[model samples]
Target: MSSKTGLLVITNPKQIGLVLSSVQQKVSKILYIQLLNALSDSASGVHTKIFSSIPKYSKEINGIYTQAARHCKHLDVRVLLSGMKHNLTKIKTQNPIDIVIFDKVFSQTEIDSFLSGKISTLTNNYKILTLNNTSEQNSEELVPEVSSEEEKRTFKHGVIGGTFDRLHIAHKLLLSELALRTDSKVTIGITDENMIQSKVLHELIQDLSTRIENVRNFISDICPDLQYDIVPISDPFGPSIVDPTMDMLIVSRETLRGGHKVNEVRDSKNLPKLYIHSVELIDEPERDPAEEVKISSSTMRMRLLGTLLKPVEINKNIPSKPYVIGLTGGIASGKSGVSHWLQELGGLIIDADKIAHGIYKCGKPCYDLLIQKFGEDIVGKDGEIDRKKLGAIVFKDRNELEKLNNTVWPEMLTEILKIVRNATEDVVVVDAAILLQAEWQHYCHEVWTTLVPKEEAVKRLVERNQLSEEQALLRIQAQPTNSSYAAAANVVFCTLWHKEYTRQQVQRAWNLLRERMCEDVLANCKNC
Candidate 1:
């Protein structure tokens, strides 16, 4: 192939890098490749422009540009945003595109239109090439140890089991293979909490519902016609031991023993053994010369806890409205009263407790997770979470409380940020009992905590819930004190006085907030 300017047309962003690599190998010298795609616009007519930078396009196009830049770092690259009009002659005259490449197979009509002498001035000058269409069997052959023959075998009902925590590429590939091999249905058994405790960073394992939903969505995306059943498994065997109708069991190399155990258990039950289909484990290349051989969930979890997981980025550019405040206090510290006063003063309050309650409803992910972590006793007769039972379990043990916090706090922060982002009010208050403990103060401009004496809180609880003095005191002792709140608070409002006094304190805070808003507006004006 001659060294010439090339124009490549690709539909999928993922194919950009592969096409660029192929073209670079074929050409003798470095090629200047212009990636062309048309954007739909009603106002702009036939406007063809080149992007000078990668970040100036939509996210999808930007991803393609990034991939192309990485693959062709030593070569010249530009992206052309084509308009509706098929002005091939104008495009060729402006760019001197001597070689044209199509990443996808084109129909006869498309080929004729592109090579037509009436429209394209370079119909005779440019060399046109189309990418080779690779079959699924060829694609499977590219994987080192995977055989296309195994994937071609079909089963009536297939069984596969895993914790499926923090679903990654390996899990997706495994599920996709199972879905493709199963003709009627595939049973996916996600390990329950009991089985997941030995896994790395078990606290970060997603809830059962989340794992099931993720697997379902992934299989549907890969093989939409296949039917799948996702269920929680408390043991290694899962449904394979009991479901005599299952014809196949899919397992990784490491879990081949478990597959055999399932067959043994089935033999004892007088059921036929399942046909075991083993898949090779996917391994990552060694980062260091003396590194481990395999990549597993433990390694992924360690990476996530160490460096892969980053703190949520806060946007410094403030929206037009909503100066957010994080309100925190100990139990029975009168935060509700303070939030009420703020609402009366025209501040919109988002109650994190209310949001948590909604999240903990029966059939919700949190509810099921809580039940799995705790016991059936934590659920009431009506099948709802019994707050008293859960409180008793957690409030007495600090470690248990921390476990609960680790599970729920991230979700709470997400919802709180979403509410603040969409709030139309000038001031928005997030009232959460564990606001400082959860580190949600990062989402707010300021932290405001309510404080009341321990004795007063105990007395209020005794009167409010008709509890004995000793019981109320135990509840108060389990929580952080007023001094702890004051340590993390930007503003502390002592709520020991009457309702009017509490309202007055809120009024003063509101006045300060208004002043801050005015100062912000003035600073923005000065900058403008």
Candidate 2:
């Protein structure tokens, strides 16, 4: 009856059926004891469900999550039942949910087998997030979501969830936004990589430990008061359906689209949709009107190789033609420090935030657009936009943020590109946290995430911002809780230690990037 902790638990179909039967029947003997033990050991919280074989178990679990989603606007849940690993090739044509479950944990060897099967299968260009365990302990910790051997299920209170691969500023910004908007505690889900597939993604950077650690660190630093857990679900739809005590599900534009699709599927089954709390898109600062290209991890990578255009004024500071480095970090991970270092070295910092700031300055089109959509209420007395009020409205509610972004992204991208084209600096850093999430990785010469200790980050925010425990907690909540963003980044800078250590890491990375850039330039010269 109290708020429940959202936990992602995995189990084999047969085991799930037995466990459900035992729970429903009020069996208190050996079978029930074993079930309890299993649940407690593997997962904790009311957001627990069985991944089993029996048709009856599936029906019961589905009904529970669906009912939860309907009664509580704060909670969302669903169950992943079908799709074995070998069936991935047929994912597009078969059930989409089933396909995702299959691929979520496929090994390289399994993938090869699928590719070589007689069906003449083609690899989906979409990049699924992946984590490779290096140690035995890690292997056990990073076990794929499916389990033939089950664990006990115990429910905790307070739940929040998100797909936080490359924990960026936008993500943290939203989390911070949420903590401010709600009085309830929070829990989160790191969207299973299987469900997230994009045509453009390629490399899988920073494994699960890094991603989890990033999330742990970010949350510990930003929102220490809120109880947090890494809930594991095969798809966004599942946890929202079954998690009984969950009050709400956090969503962004990308995830919203996925959740909507999930709802459509659920509706076909005559089920209700999950209650979702949508976060608004954090608009990257705009560039000059003449600058039209978008900023992204991909674009940043391309720019670094001289295969893409430079930003406005980015080419002016260096010894030779500008060398653009894609700089990114987890929410509140001190990307500014890295950018400052690059600037101190006489390199140009083609700041995404600054460009975004330029876009929203007085007399810009974004201002007019915001006024039209959200009205003048969000504007301050000085005729300037009120960021806090606007953020509150957008991040707490999904539809509003979508409307805001639809108007801004096109124009924002155009302006950003123009800046890139006119840039002429020797070393320009495209400082964007969501370069990958924005599908901008193709443009980056290389992408990096600011890695920091969650404890240190918490201390820094509390000290630097002069915020109360709760306020600083909210700020950290506003970013990515983990390194899920690593899937999209090429490199990461661990900032848990001292600032000097961070600088040293950056220096080494910059040196390597420099060599790669030189090679790329030479190759281009030959082609010319």
Candidate closest to the true structure, highest TM-score: 1
- Per residue, candidate 1 scores C-alpha lDDT tens digits across 332-357 of 88999999988988899999999888
In order, what is each prediction's RMSD in angstroms?
Answer: 19.7, 21.3
Q: Pick the candidate with the highest lDDT.
A: 1
Candidate 1 structure lDDT: 0.65
- What TM-score, computed on C-alpha atoms, does each candidate reach? 0.40, 0.39
TM-score of 1: 0.40
Instruction: State the C-alpha lDDT per candidate.
Output: 0.65, 0.47
